[model samples]
Target: MSRIVFLEERCKGCRLCVEACPAHILRPSGRFNHQGYEIMEMDGQCTGCASCAVMCPDTAIRVFRSVKIRNTAGEGAA
Candidate 1:
């Protein structure tokens, strides 16, 4: 799974992330940040492709992925 964290105060609300996100996961916060910019965030449907992170001009967004592994033992297992 992947998660996105938005740095509200650092955001300039330039909409670059919104345009860059292929999944269309980023959107305006509708509220102003500490810098008075309409921050952007990845919606619940984000696929975690990191498109937004690359396009953000202010570098206020970050995408992180978590890797999971499963182990099982069976009769045929070595």
Candidate 2:
């Protein structure tokens, strides 16, 4: 499963990540951080897409994607 982490303190509440999220998992959180700006929230539905991170001007979001390896056991068996 893919996941994302947001550096809350570095976020400037620009909401660019929210708009760049294709999975619709990012939203404007009603809470404020130490900087007094509304933060963003993730719904744990990240698709490993870097769209959010690319759009974030502050580089607040980090994405981690799990690589799945498929077994090729039968490729040369026959």
**Candidate 2, run of 10 with poorest lDDT:** 41-50
Candidate 2 Cα lDDT to native: 0.89
> lDDT of each prediction vs. the true structure?
0.82, 0.89
TM-score of each: 0.80, 0.89
Candidate 2 residues 1-78, lDDT tens each?
888888999999999998888888998889899989999988767889889999999999898998989998888886
- Relative to the unseen true structure, what is the Cα RMSD of model 2? 1.4
lDDT of 1: 0.82
Best by lDDT: 2
Q: What ranges in model 1 sit over 4 Å off?
A: 70-78
The number of the candidate with the highest TM-score is: 2
